[model samples]
Target: MSAEFDVRYTAQLARLSLTDAEAAKFQSQLSQVLVYVEKLKQVDVSGVEPTAHSSEMNNVFRADEPRDWFTSKQALSNAPRQANDLFVVTKVIE
Candidate 1:
């Protein structure tokens, strides 16, 4: 289960600098990870169905229905200032 990936090349591509000792250490550690991944490949999952969750799931949403909205007069009735059916605001910039 030897990892054959070029760690130095990978480090260079990732914009990292490593000493020889660090590169050797990482190569060994990465090889161990690959060995575990290879072990997972040996597991039998052919009979298992793929699912996003372990429990039964259902959507909990309310039904959508259209209703009447406030008219322009009703919306502007509470405005501090109004002119020509529009809300009047103070000038903010010169």
Candidate 2:
């Protein structure tokens, strides 16, 4: 079955350049993976529930609420350089 799955042709399809040895190695690895997947099919999953994640997902974000915002002076206090109530970053373009 692994022989039928041509690694060289698949690599070409993906525009990948693989040496003969590399292709052979990948072929063996892919075959082992497929075999494992096939073995998984033999397991009885009738009683198990299908789930997208292994653990429950909940939003980690804090609730949006109106609060006292920073003043312009407070905001610019930590800046290394400031002019006209704005941070003065170094010129990036000529």
Candidate that scores best on lDDT: 2
Model 1 Cα displacement at 91 (Å)? 46
lDDT of each: 0.87, 0.88
lDDT of 2 by residue, 1-94 (tens): 5557888888999999899899889999998887777877788999898897677986679879988999999999999999999999989998
CA lDDT for candidate 1: 0.87
Looking at model 1, how many pairs of residues clash? 0
lDDT of 1 by residue, 1-94 (tens): 3556778988999999899999999988987787778877778999888898878877768779978999999999899999999999889897
- For candidate 1, which ten residues in a row score worst on lDDT? 1-10
Would you list the clashing residue pairs of candidate 2?
none
User: How much is 85 displaced in model 2, in angstroms?
Assistant: 27
Candidate 1, after superposition: displacement of residue 22 in Å?
Answer: 0.3
Q: Estimate TM-scores for all models.
A: 0.42, 0.42
